[model samples]
Structures are given as C-alpha cells and as structure tokens.
Target: MSLSSSVEFPARFSYACFRLTPHSVYAINATILPQKCRLSTILTAPSFDELFPDALVNPSRPSDLHSDPFWAPTLSVDLSDASGIWIHLGKAPAAQCDKLLINVYKEYSNDSSRVSFLETLEVKCPETAVKWENQRAGKYLLTAYVPIRGCKFLCDSADKHCRQCLRTHLSLEIRENRASFIWLALHTMKDHSYEIFIISAVLVGLIMLVMCMGMVYALWKQRRDAKRVQEIQLTMYVKAMLIYADDCVEHRNCMRMLVECLRHCATCEPVFDMEKLLQPDSVIPSRWLIDQIATLPKFIIVISECGSRILDTTESRTHHLVQARPFADLFGPAMEMIIRDATHNLIASKRKYCIVRLPYSPEVPANLAVLNFPVFNLPDQFGQLTAFLHDFENIDQLNISQPLSQSRMTSFREAVRLQMTFFEQNPDWLDTRWRPIDEPAIPQIREQRLPVEISTDEDRIAAAKLYGIDPPRADSEDEETGVGPSNERQFMLHPPANEPDSDTDDDDLSTSEDEIDDEDEEGGEMHTVVFRPDNLF
Candidate 1:
C-alpha cells in the first residue's frame, strides 16, 4: 500500500519531481522517491470498505469487490533483498500528507477478519524534499515507511522508542501505487485550447469579408446616380438641324427616320447647304441663304449617304435655293447681306464649326471636319441616334450609348412616313420660276497709291456724310457737341443732337444695333457699332 496526492505548481516550471519523509519516530510518514512514470499522487491506507465504498460487504447480502475494475487491486513485488516492502506510487506530491494522522489495526480472537486498534500515528510531511532533474516518464517506488535511525531525547527509553517507531512504519505504508487526479485535468484543458483558437479566427475572417463587399456596393451606387443626373441635363439642351434628300426615291427609309427623329426634338430646323444651292435653276438670292446660316445656335446635323449625294446633285442643289425663296422674300436683300457677312466670318476663322460624322459614311470630305467639330460614328438605329445627340459630350468619346426605346422608335418611323407624303405632294412648291444666276467671283484689284493720305478729319467727315450725319465742327463752342478726339474717324459715327440723321431702313442695321465691333478706339475702349450701308462702302 502507498499514500498519494498531487500538487500543481504555477506555469513557470515545465515539470518537477520530489521525495518527502516525516522526521520524528512517533509520526507515520510517506516519501516520494524518483521514478520513471506519469506524474501522480500516492494514496494512504484505509479499510477495504473505505477504499471501495460502493462495494461494501453486508452480512445479510454478499458483495463482490473483485469483479469491478475500480475496486480491484493489483500487487507487485521487488526483487531487491530488502527486509521492508516496497510501495510504488506514481509522481504524487509530498505535501498531501502534511499533518495527516492514521491508525493501524490488528486482528484478534478466532475471527481472522475482525480487526482492533494497534497504534495511532501522526504523519508529518514536508513541503518539498528531494527534487529530480529530468522529466522522464515511468513508474516510481516510494518507500512510505522509512524509520528514523537516531533520536536524541526519545532514546532514553530504548525499548519504548523501538516499539513506537515500528508502530509508525506500519501506519505509513498501508496503501500502494496510486494515480494523480491533476495530470488528467491538465491533459483535458490542453485539448480544448486548439479548438477555441480555430473558432475565433474563422469568426474574424467572416466579419472582414462582409465589410469589404458593403464598401464596393456603396461606391457603385453613387456613380450610377451621378450618371443619371447628367443624362437629364443633356436631354434638355438637345436641338437638331436636319439636312435630308428631297428626291424621296433614294434612301427614303433613312430619310423618313431622320425626319421623325428631328421632329421629336424641341426644335428641328432645315439647313440648306451652300454647295447645294449653287445650282443653275436656283431662285434663292445669295443674301437669303446667308441669313439662314447665321441664326444657328448649338445644333446637331445628321447627314445620310443619300442626303450627301443629293447636295452634290445639280437638280437637288437648284431645288434647295428655290425652296429658300420665301426666306429671301421675308428678310429681303439687306438681311441677306447680314447673313453673308456672318457666314464669311465663320468661314474665314473656321473655328466654330460643330460637325458630327455619321456611321453611315466614312467617305465624307475632310473639309467638313473643321476645328473643334467633334465627329461621332453612330449606330444605324434612330433611337440610338436620339440618345447619342442628347448626351454626346458627357459620354465616353470612344463609344456610343445605345439606349434604344421601342416606343420612340415606332413613333419616329410613323412620322417619317407622313413627312415623305408631304414632300411628294409639295414637290413643285419650292421649285418657283424666280431662279437667279450665280454672281461673278469677286474681282481682285492691285493696290493703287492714293494721290494724298486721307486725314483723320476727312475720314470723320466722310463717315458722317455716309450715314447722313452733320458732324460737329472741330471749332464748336460746346465740347459735348463735338466727337471726342479718341473716337474721331472710327468706323462708327454717333448721330449729332443738332441734326437728326436720316433713318436708314436697312435689315443689315435693324439687327446690327447690338453687334459689338472688334475695332478698338484710340483710348483702348471697344467701339460698339451698328452695320450701316456705309460700312459696306
């Protein structure tokens, strides 16, 4: 039999082994000697009923303690020639038996099973005794009953001391070879630690994944809303200027679709190409054609292959000018001159042309491609053309937007059919007999020397007389009556208060009052002038 129990040190130590014993002769003691086995504690001796509590034998009913694994006891013997028995207990702590008391029993009379009290011993165990170096795993034998050899004060009665020491040894080694409960608990905790770590890492990874997805979705939504707002604004600013074939035979399908698309726009106006109107049978004066070209704002021009061919035809060219007769009649030659000047200004600078190239024709002339005029190669669909004209600037310049609405497409097709019918019935309406021949090309003249350099005063007098204004004399008494010296001889002349200028009913001057002149005065101020018949001189 062996006495055993376990103690756990804090985590600083990897593993520790110890041997302990009681010092006094009157005390029972248990010691942990070094061994090669798992760490365990030794259990002290007790009656069979106390050791296996569930298997107690009753006189009325028999019980079997040998059948159960927990109640069974195995014994081993040591080959060493020692007089005392060897009690091996696994790595039990020495401190379990500290101040523990035990009683030894003896059998008497004829009943061998009966027992009586033999001796009572107090066990005095130390906190720590023998410490081992290695953590070797094997069994260990703890000789629980080691008798004290020398006793100074108690040795006066040698016989009494001998008997007491024998009795204490008997009490100490009553139990043998027990296991430690603490080692089992330590193994169980280590197993659960790995599972806990894995569970926590998985939870954290899932949370990060969800956050990333939400961030991406929010960014995508914000950009979508911004694009929608731009679409609405672009649609409102859309205006179309259509140039189509009048023949109604070639490209009739495309031409009708073009008209339908143009009608859907807030403003759809026809523009007559100057090249087309330079035909023999043309009735439109050059001035009428010029006025129509000058009043244009930001406009989209859709040209089909057939319409392009029509402009290059003599018959169609003549028809365009004749159709423009009504415009010339209403605005007259004066308005026509204003238009001619504006067109000439645009043609000279060639900076403000806004031309869009259709996907229908790649052979369109390079002359049509002017500065700052973007070219788009659109798809053949009408609805796509409408959407492209709406937001062409804000869209990706490389690709065309194809948001085809079926309803708009159907309506446009129907509108084109009606337009073709009107054109067929009114074929001769624009073909009036007022055909005018083209004017001769402007004659170039060599620069001639003037007999005398015209003085500033002479320029002022000439301009004043041309506008029928009697300019204030330089020797005038009132400074207000005379033109400022800085403004003298400028292209523009303000009417004098003393003499009312003749009213010139020219269309050129009618709309030119607000036109700012680029010519600067000597004082660096811009001269705001209306174009009168004198400016043409």
Candidate 2:
C-alpha cells in the first residue's frame, strides 16, 4: 500500500497579531479558555513534497502519470472566521470513476517567511454541520483540511493589498475513469494584519491625544495657582482712607452713603469727621485732626461742581463762601496735613490721593486737577476703585452694595433724580464775586490867585485862580466863594458882653473896625472883605 499517515498537533490557545498558520486558523474570541485538546509535538512524516509527488504511475494502465496533471476547475471561496469552506463538486459523472482526493495546505502570503507550516492536526473535515454552521455539500467530503505543518494556500482575493498565501495551487486526479467535474476551493483565512495595523495606529493616536490634553491642562492649572500664590504673598494691608468733600447737600448725602458702604465692607477703615461734614456751621477740629493724620494710606477727594468750588484755594475762602462752607475749618487743617505729608512723598502725592467724580458734578480745582491724580469717574469706575483698595488675593473686601435692597434702591433713585435736577441747573449757583479794593483819598485844590477884571463871583474866582491873588470875601453872605483868608468869627472867641454883636470874627478885629471907619472908602472895601462874619476859607 502506498504510505499515508494521519497526524495531529495542538494549536495555540489564541492567536494575536501573529498572522498565519499552515491551515485556516480563525478565532472568534482569543481570550476564552480553550477546550482540552490532545497535543502532539511530532511533525508530519518526512515532508509534503515527498508524499504528494509530481509523478503518479498507474499499475493497471502501465503508463507514467506524471508531469503537470490537469486540476479540476474550482469556484471562488473565502474562509474567514471559518464556518468551513464549501467545495462544490459540480456535476459528477453517472458512474464511479476512481478514488477522490481532498487537500489543504498553507504558506506565508509574503516571501519573507521561509519557515513552513508550523503545526498540524489529524481531524477530518466534518461532512455536514448544524444549521448555524451552514455546511453545504451533497455526497463527497466537500471540504479539505490539513495539519498546519504541511503546505499550500492561495494568494488571490479581491482586495489586492492583503497578504496572499504565495499563490497556493491545488491538484486532483482520477484512475480507471473519465473525470469531468467542477468544484469550489478556498486558500486561507484572512489574518487582518493591514486592518489591525490601521486600527492600532488610530488607537495609539487617540491615547497620545488624551495624554497631551491632560498635560496641557495640568501646566495651565499649575501656572494659575502659582500666580495666585505670588499675588497673595505680595499683598499689603487693606489700610484706611479719608474722604474730603464739599458742603453741597447732595454731595454730603453721597459722602455719607459711601461712608456707610465702606463701613459695611471690611476692606478699609474710613477716617472721616461726620460731625464736621454734617453740622450746619461746623469748623475743623484741628486738635483732634492732628491725631487722625498720623497714618495716611488713602485719601479720597470727592469732586463735584460744588466740591470743586469748595476746594478752590482763593475762591472758596472768600468772604461769603468762607462762612457758607461747613467744612471750611476742617478743609484748612486737612489740606495742610495732606500737603505736608505729600510734599516730595511720591506715594502720598500720587498714589495715596484719589479723585472721584460723581454724576452731574463737573467743578474741579485748577491746582488739584494739575496734580494729575488717578481719577475715577463713577459709578462706572466703582469696580476699579474696589480693585485699587484691595490688597489680598482672595479678599474682596471693598464690596459696595451691588444688589441693593428695594428701600436703598429707592433712595439711590431719588439721589439720581436730584443729581439730574442739579445737572439741569447749570453754573448759576457759583459765586463769581470778589472783594472790593480801595486807595487813599486826595483833593484837587485851585490856584490861590485871581484876576482884577473879575466882577461877578465866578469871574472873581476865575481871576483868583489865574492871578494867584486873594478874591473879595464880600460876595455872598450865605456861601463862601472867596479865595482870601477872612476874619470869620471864632466860636471860642466871643465879643464882650458890653460890646454890641458885630460881623467881625475877631475881638481885636472889632477894635480895628472902628479904626477902619476913619480910613478911606477904598480901605473900607478891603476892610469889609476882612471883617465879614460869613467869610470862611
């Protein structure tokens, strides 16, 4: 008998990416524990080439049946995840021809693998299978199987890029019969290497992507936390602030409201003289204020049309406004302290002082405005002010009422209405008046001489001014138009009780008047001019 032996070998529990075996090895689940199977380490006797020789000699015919033999034509078949491949032996002859042969073998798709089929098995191909197995064959064993150690498998599939089993070829022959048949045959199961490579690349890319994202987030978080810690480390004390404002009714109200808000916020201590700001005629408590100015962290000057007016150095300290400003006394001391501390103190001058402009207020001091202090126009820059006052990283202590209560909101609305009304009334309330100035008095006196051509009093006075001589004192008894010194009566000097009252002013002149009657009438004219009681110079 021509030698033929059955051989069996064990398979690995599961295949990984290790692509191929001698026969079709398809696994549904690689991790599942395999059933107990008897194993053999022994390989096939000799090898595949020696057993299935190219030459066959027929004993009955006495002819050499060798060289290339005709193989039956086969239909295309694929065996992946093997349900087992069908070999359709189409239209067999009506008479029994000879012994039929079924064969299976495998080799690597690429030429790189010189190692042959590495394992084997002896189990015969099942003739029929359950419905799910989908076996399709009529009579002859329609499927071929082999122990992996033996050889042969095909290279062609529709997908050309896939690994092909080295153009595996199949052959069949019949003895003492005329053989005419068609059949189906399969090469090998697909190893899925190309698809697996792509999937693994995508999976690796996804894992790397996740790792990169996580690293980026970690770096960002670390930076943010470090910055916050540094800020906290450098934080200064919240400190204190002093408010300087005008005597305006609305301004005072707003200042008081701000004071209240600052009180609510634990951020900074507000140092303000409520008494001086509130009272109708309060003066500065200079003695007490000395103690207050000892520490100065922040100083807020509330600016408004009214505040600007009050803060004016020369204008606000005028006669009327000086009394009008309730904080007049306080302003002087406060300003003196600020200027003293601020002089050459850059922090005190620039940083410590802040100017805030409320709505509907425009007046600003020329000197103060020139200082270029940080100006916050509110309620817009209110948040900026809070940030400015805060020193701690997480401590947001300067919380002005954001969502105010209804009552407080109503009050704020009312204040807004008042401010709008004030806006409507322009600069009419500003006092533009200044103090009056005066110089010493001096009278313009005429010349002490007159012209002789003068007849009337006007002419005589004119002539007196021109000639630089005395004019007649005898003109009007009621008015003194004369230029000469006349003997007018002295209230201290009185005529003797015995003597008659006379027009002469001098007691000695009365005696001279009697002597004048004895002189010429021309002398009488000079005499008359000198003795008139109405004459005054």
Each candidate: how many clashes? 16, 16
lDDT of each: 0.38, 0.44
Candidate 1 residue lDDT tens string, 362-445: 354333433334444433343334544444344332233344356755654455555456556766633332233353323335
- Model 2: lDDT equals 0.44
- Model 1: how far is 396 from its true place, Å? 2.5
Error of 2 at 139 (Å): 86
Worst 10 residues of 1 by lDDT: 69-78
Question: Against the true structure, what is each candidate's TM-score?
Answer: 0.25, 0.32
CA error at residue 510 for candidate 1, angstroms: 56
Q: Highest TM-score: give the candidate number.
A: 2
